[model samples]
Target: MASMLEFRTPGWNPYAVKYSPYYDSRIAVATAANYGIVGNGRVFCLGLGPQGIQVEKTFDTNDAQYDLAWSEINENQLLVACGDGSIKLYDMNVNDFPIMNFHEHKREAFSVAWSPVTKDTFASSSWDGTVKIWSPARKDSIQTLPVGNCTYSTAYCPSNPSLISAVSTDSHLRLFDLRTPASAQYHLTAKIPVHVPSPAPLPQGPSPPAVPGEILTHDWNKYNHTVIATGGVDRVIRTFDIRNPSGGPASVMMGHEYAVRRLAWSPHASDILVSASYDMTVRLWTDGSTMPAQQASPVKAGIQLGIMNRHTEFATGVDWCLFGVGGWVATVGWDERVLLWDANAMLRGQA
Candidate 1:
C-alpha cells in the first residue's frame, strides 16, 4: 500500500483557490479573513486569527459579493457575480471596488467562467435557466444560449471556443454550439434522466453495476477540448467524443460508491483521471485502453488509486493547477475549503 497524496508545499490554509493573471502566484483565494495572494498557486495563509462566522472580520460573500471569476487576459481584473443580477469588475492592485457592474441576468448567476481560447469572452448561467456569453467591451451579450431548465453549472469546450455544455436542475444535459446564425437559441442535443437500473450479481462478483444513463455535469478536458468527461447522479464517469455527437462514450469509468460531483484530467498527464463523489472519496484512474493494465482484472477496472480523499465538505469542483512548479489538483466543497491534492505523487508506485 502506498499513499496517493503528499505535500508539495503548504502555502495557504484558506478556504477557496482561484488563479488570475494579476496575482503573483496567479492565485487569488477567499478565506475567513482577507483575500490571500499567491505567486503561482502557492499561498501563505496570512490572517490575524479566527472569528465567529458572523464577525465583521470573517470573510464571507456578503451582499456585496457572490460568485467570482478571474479574467484571462487581464490578470488584475476580477469579475464578481452579485446576487442583484450584476457582475462587478474588481481591480486588485488599487483595492478599489468594481470598475463595471453588468446587470443582465434577472436572477442570481450560479456560476461564471472565462473562455480559455477567446480573450475577453466569458459565459454565465443563471438560476433563471439561461446561459449568456458576455464581453466587457460590450454591455449586452452577443449570444444568449437558451436552456430548457435552470442551469446548475456550465463549462466551455476546450477545443472550440464557441461550444458549451450545461446541466439543469431538471437533471438534463444540454450542449450548445455558438456557430449558428441564431446562436442565441440552443438546441437540446441529448437529454436523459439521471438514474440507473439495479444490477444482478454475476458469478464474477457483480458485473460492472448498472448506473444512470444521463450525465450529471461535464468538464471539457484541459488537454483535449473535443473530449468531454461527465460525472453523474448514477455514479459513473462517462467520456464522450463531442467531435462526433453520434460517437458513444470512449469508456465508462466506475469507482465511486455514490453520485460523483467532479471529474478532471491531470494537466501534465493526459491519461490520468481524478474524480470526487458524495461518498467522500476521490479516485484516480489511468486510461487503460491499450495496455496490460486495461485487462488486469475486469471486475476491478479503470481505477488505480482509491484514495481516502479527506475534505471539509463534499467535493463539488476539481481543477488541475501548477503551483510554483509541479502539478496539483484543487478541489472545492460545501465546507468552503479549497484543498490541494498533490496529484504528482499519486502514481509514485508505478513500475
Candidate 2:
C-alpha cells in the first residue's frame, strides 16, 4: 500500500476527522464553508478504497460545523456540533436531512465526544460556557455541567462511564464524576489549572512562572485513565494526572510554533500521541514517562518523535487508524485537504 493518500473537500474546510470504530475503510469529517466564519456547514462520510479517499455521503446544515463523533451504539449514525449552538444526528442510511436536531446551547458547539463505555450517551462543550450530556433518544440534555467559561473540548473517560472531563478558555481542566450526588456541586469532581509552574525545578535553573492561557483541545490517554493531555493558545501541550491535580503536569510537550488545534493519544501505545496545530503541521510525541532519560531527569518532558507538514493551512484534526498495525493516521485541515499516511513509515524514515 502507498504510504500516503490525499483528498480535497473543495470549498469546505474541515475542522475534525474521525475514523469509524466499526469499519477501517470508513471515516467522517466535519467541515465549514468560508473557514467557519459566515457560511454553511457539512458532514462528509468518506470511504477509503484502492483508488483513494471517496465521499460516500454528505449532510448539509445552515450553521458551521466544528466537530463530530461517530455513534458508538450504531454503525450507521453520527453526531455533529455546529456554530448555531446545535447538535445534529445524521444517519448514513437516511437521505439528505438529519434524523434529529439538538439545539439547547446558546453559542457555537465546539466539540462532541461519545461515551466509549456507555455507548448510548455523548457529551458536548460549547462557547456558551457549559458542557451538556445527551442521549440520542431524547430531545433535551440529560444534564448540563457549568464550565463557567467557553468550554472548547469535553470527553467521557474511556474506562469509566460515570466520569467526564472538559477544558476551557479559563485555562482549567474540570472533571465531573456523574456518580456523585448533584447537590454536591453538579457532580463536579476536580478543577486543575493546566498552566501552573512545575513543582520540580529544571536541573539548569529554576522553572519559569506559569501564565494562564486559553485551552483549546485535550484528550485522555486511552491506556492511562489518570493521565490527560491538553494544548491551546499557549502553543504548549501538557499532560496532567487527575489523581494529583496539584502536583502539576505529569509531563510537558512543547514544539508547535502556533497554537495546538487538536490532539489524540494513540490507541496502541500508552506513551504515544499526535497533535495538529495552527502551524500547518501534525507532530508525533512520546510523553517520555517510559523513556530511560526522562525517568532519570528531575523534570519530565515529552520528546518529539516526528512531524508531518504537508497541510498548507491550519491542521485542525487527526485520528489514528484503530484496526491496523496502529500507525496509519488521518488528518484534516483548513486547506480543504485530508491526508492519510503511514506514521510508522515516517518514523522509520526518521530513524
Best by TM-score, which number?
2
Each model's TM-score? 0.72, 0.96
Off by over 4 Å in 2: 203-209, 293-298
RMSD (Cα, Å) of candidate 2?
1.8
Candidate closest to the true structure, highest lDDT: 2
Candidate 1 weakest lDDT stretch, 10 residues: 40-49
The residue-by-residue lDDT of candidate 1 on 1-351, one tens digit each, is 232222212222233335443432344443222222222111212211133111111222333232456788876666665445566666655443456667688876656777878766888877677888889777778777777566656777766787778876665556776765563345445443333322222223344445434344566666766666767776777665565554445556776778786676766655577787777666777654434533334222344554636664555556566434445566554454555546656666431
lDDT of 1: 0.56
What is the TM-score (0 to 1) of candidate 1? 0.72
State how far residue 212 of model 2 sits from its true place (Å): 0.6
lDDT of 2 by residue, 1-351 (tens): 247888899999999999999999999999999999999999999999987888899999998999999999999999999999999999999999989899999999999999999798999999999999999999999999998899999998889999999999999999999988997588888999988988775433335349998999999999999999999998888999898978888888888899999999999899999999999999999998787764344467787889999999999999998988889899999999999998887777641
Model 1 misplaced stretches (Cα beyond 4 Å): 1-16, 21-24, 30-67, 82-85, 183-216, 287-301, 304-308, 322-326, 349-351
